[model samples]
Target: MPVGHFPLQDKIVVITGGGSGICFSFAQLALTSGARGILICDLQLTPAAQDLINQTPDEVHFMKCDVTDWNDLEAIPPKVEEAFGKGQVGDVWIAGAGVFEPKWSSFIYDEEKEGGYKAMRINAEHPIKLTRIAMRSAISVNKPCAVLIVSSGAGITGQYAAALYCATKHAVVGFTKSMGQADIDENCKIVCILPGMVSTPLWTGRSDAVASQFSYTDEVCITPEDVAQGMKEMIEEEKYPGGSLMSIAKGKLRNVLESKLAFANDGSEIYKQFESKCYAPIREIWNGERGTKLS
Candidate 1:
């Protein structure tokens, strides 16, 4: 059988925080995958987003946007609708916003002077607000759509001296999961991506917290191309809807904790129970059978 071609052809996609870093990388990949029109929005319309647009064959547009500002997010739908000559977006990617500032002595410590609110507003709140707007736009257009939220491993497991950053990431994960259930129409998918310390300008001139935590020899880390590849794979696969897909360093993909767990009884017994009681029953119900009748 022939392999499927890029599924994003002619799709109107919107990416917030698209001016730099992983978001920009994703935009480049989306263009290669045949995206028709892309709107790259960031807090300050940087030349970088436009630069990516210039390099691609796709029709790319850039917008100056601050994700924390609800009005700015609310305005995006109409702008995108006008561009596409329709009031709905096909796919929306929330990648342009993130913060990795260090935390103070305590959990309650606030560092307004060091851009703490910027972290929370961009990393957590902005994605949630953007998702709402995108979902509404998708529904109004009556088209299938997907929302990809960029999260961090810190969002999954809290790190020392990074409480605020962790809090925001965790919030993103929660928001993705909650929205996934509420907005599960045949045409909508919500996904959260947990990226671990990709190399980008976002980390430039920043503290060594990420390097130290990940045990990097030099300050260098995973590249933007690496992250862009992962994003492209996830979008193309389409198997991970409403799920948190984690991309870690090579040779470290599996969840070792889950794999190595030793149950009280043998694994086969557990599998039997799960298959007979859970999977089998659910499959039967989904297939429109009342119950299995053993003759």
Candidate 2:
């Protein structure tokens, strides 16, 4: 195990979607690892999550948060302060809340659905918004922080049936990798994990619309605990660098190469010329040659 820069011991953590699944499992492990405080934020609480909070009422806390709502996300910093007290900028911020494109908000049924794709808001936009909040909060206090983003195998590998879901995941992968390009040491570290077919409520619950799509053999499915453990290692032991993408699959953890796994950009001269032409006008605008206001 490589030595990690961030340690869970005596540190405060805030997890979105901590009511169940990967986030819930990680919350449990965070307590055992001697974390000082954990705020589990989600739409509602699962029985197991409620039970854990009941057992460790002093250490574990719960807050109802809708990831899609900016107000809900904006309230997190104060909630964290309220639970753990002032100046307690969280050490770990887990954007684990996501949905696997369901019937109500799926691309296939876009015409029937009202408002935009909820899965895109939940899975893609939520992480992006949450990362901005987490990084800023921690940096303002000059504290070390890590933002763990939960993506899916679908983000890297496409699935025809779940195009919306795949796109949401891909969005985060690209966002995390792009964020990694910055000098994170001065601000905060951000990492993303892509879990392949985990046996969680997202896939195992009979009520889940996507459950039927995952009818593969049991051998191929990993437990939420497996992914949680991988996340724990990434946070504590593995010490994955800022902007690293780790894949948890088949009871193993592997590094996802940014170029190949997410966007395999062919370094063709023609492509470079195309990209340059596409960016030249935008760059000129950015340099104030053209007006900056979009509206």
Q: Pick by TM-score: which candidate is best? A: 2
Q: For candidate 1, write residues 56-129 as lDDT tens digits.
A: 63378777787777888888877776666654454655555776764532245574675447677878888888
- Residue 123, model 1: lDDT of 81
Show where candidate 1 strays beyond 4 Å.
Answer: 1-6, 45-48, 55-58, 86-90, 102-109, 113-116, 205-220, 253-295
What does candidate 2's lDDT look like per residue over 59-170, in tens digits?
Answer: 9999999998999999999898899876676889899998876777888867534568888899999999998888667656656577889998777898888889899999
Query: Could you say which candidate leads in lDDT?
Result: 2
TM-score of each: 0.73, 0.83
Q: Kindly report the root-mean-square deviation of model 2 from the true structure over all alpha carbons.
A: 6.8
Worst 10 residues of 1 by lDDT: 256-265
**Any runs in candidate 2 off by more than 4 Å, and if so which?**
1-4, 182-185, 237-239, 259-295
lDDT of 2: 0.80
